[model samples]
Target: MRSVIDIVDLTAAEIDGLIATAEDIIANPAKYSEKCRGKKLATLFFEPSTRTRLSFEAAMYELGGNVLGFASADSSSATKGETVPDTVRVVGCYADIIAMRHPKEGAPLAASMYSPVPIINAGDGGHSHPTQTLADLLTIKREKGRLSDLTVGFCGDLKFGRTVHSLVKALLRYEGIKLVFISPDELRVPDYIRDELESAGADWLETASLEQAMPELDILYMTRVQKERFFNEADYIRLKDSYILTADKMALGKSDMCVLHPLPRVNEIPMEIDEDSRACYFKQVKNGKYMRMALILKLLEVE
Candidate 1:
């Protein structure tokens, strides 16, 4: 079996296929409801989570599959100092597939090396969240009608936003995609990301002005300034409100542009903007479940 430690682990064609499968699942719910009736999914989240964990569980349940595993390290063998490979080895014996989220970067990658079952990376520190990127791609494809030839603006905490990094990498593979990086200087997109974009000959621009960049975007992706990723309280405080998407900001964006957040949003996106037609963050969350369901099916080779 194959594991998805990074978005690049799946080719553009594979991504398209997953999006197509998700769209199919979305359109015909009953047809796929019992697709994985006998399967078991093991979620090994060594970090606290809400959306990602619940989404994976919900997805497995919707497929008629049973779910198991802890939501945090304290609840798992890791609290007793058991390592990732040791844990995955045990979990693999019980489950058909595994989805793991860890605080340490590449922990899932390391686990994948020894996993007897397919390993899905839920989130690995600030490294990558490939499944979330799948949700994002499916959302973009559904809302915008295509992933290519669109200007997408990513605002807020780019430096530590794993979703932003993963999505940016995935989007570069599409044709005619232009990226707008909107963040304060302290939280600009990482250099490696920029370097990758440059090497691929992708069009991208970095800016500190969210409002100025909004009008040009077909998709406006807002990310939270994660308090958990900060080393200094002062730095988090100063940058937390750097890019709030108020109604005024939404008005500046194109009328049909979709707004997406990987969610558990704090105050970056105002509740008032949620009523606007452009707000698709909640839809993104729903799409996430469908995408995960598609991914689990694809990885398990279940037709």
Candidate 2:
């Protein structure tokens, strides 16, 4: 079975194929309405989620498939101390495919090992979020009209932003893709990620000021500082407001520069900027559903 635990699980070519399928799905929704009519998708979200969980269920429903499973661990056997693999093994028997989101890193990988059906990692702690990366890729492709030869700025919680990690890995495969890491020192991109960039010989730079990097970025990807990911409340308070993207800051960016964010945004992005033509976060959310639909069809081998 083909399972995607990390963005690396799908090659650059596979990503391109998925993007193409997503575009086709967007253009011709009716043609794929019944592609998975009899199949079922089980969403085992052990953590709290709004977009990812709903996106998966919505994708299945749009494809004329049914969806089952819990939105939280408190509602599942996991609340009674049931293990991930065991839960996945049982769910796999009933569902044709599984999309799992867990609080513990590598939990999806462990579940994938025991699952009979294909496993799609919805999100796992701060490790990786491949499907979100797919959404990011598609959004970049659609908004910018191409994914290559563009400078992307990743702002806020780089340390705990799994979306950032996954997207960075995916973008490295493309040429002329420069990465600008905009974050406070405490929440800087992880060393392991830096190691990967260096190993790949990719062009990347880190800065504390978003304004300084804003002008050069073709895409500004903002992320909220995750209070859930922090162990110290004081630290969270100090860095939570680190990079708020205001209208003044938006002026520093290119007129055609697109802004993207994984939703459930906090004060980092104010309501005023939503009117800006550059704000594509809402577009990113809609594209997320399309990308998940494409991924579901691809993993299930449905025509």
Candidate 3:
């Protein structure tokens, strides 16, 4: 009966609960293997995605559930001009839960209004991506040992990075978290995010240099410049190579500083930095599946 449209939809306590559930699943995988037996999960991805879609399907399958749904708009009824609400209304009849990703902001919210089952917003344009934020939270908790009292630097594509926005909103609930925004003026964190940070009394700073912000960071979140989000090819080309995280750049950070990316990396993070103990992006992918599994169990009330 509940839907998650934004990271803020879940309270800090609920987030903690989900994280604990994910950690438990990680430690005792067999215990959760049959948790969703006989259940069905429908993934309605109206946009292109590999990680989010596959992660949701993988989570459901690992839970002993069946997965159904399309990977793109062309394969779905949307190509026939079927509305999001109508699509979910029909899918809700066939599935126990729905996970949706759309290029249009608020599409998932609109579907939530019509969905009979729980709706999980996988990613909706540049608006929000709650589940990815959950993954980030688990990664941060596991890597840094604690979420609070840390300086987290976000580098590249802040303006259109849904992951950064959602994670920032989630981090605001924790205490002593300093947010360092590293990007050019064109890609600075949106104004609404700034206003929320001020309202929450959270400390944050904006910088154009990643190396300058690197030394002080406990966690560095790198994001790729999304060509799909841009209307102009020229602008995309100009910012696409903005901040590349190479091995030399990693050396500027603390020995334990964790690096993360909501990936599909297009040269933002060079493979040379993968060997460093600080690179947690791959681990973040694995954590994403665990968190998603926890979310599926919670939303399905599978207890």
lDDT for position 165 in model 1:
92
TM-score of each: 0.98, 0.99, 0.99
**Cα lDDT for residue 261, candidate 3:** 97
Best of the two (1, 3) by lDDT: 3
Every model: Cα RMSD to truth: 0.8, 0.7, 0.7
State the C-alpha lDDT per candidate: 0.94, 0.94, 0.94
State in Å the error of residue 267, model 3: 0.4
Question: How well is each residue in 81-200 modelled by candidate 2, as lDDT tens digits?
Answer: 899989999999999999999999999999989999999999999889999999999999998999899999999999999999999999999999999999999989989999999999
Per-residue C-alpha lDDT of model 3 across residues 40-82, encoded as one tens digit per residue: 9999999999999999999999999999999999999898999
Stretches of candidate 2 exceeding 4 Å from the true structure: none
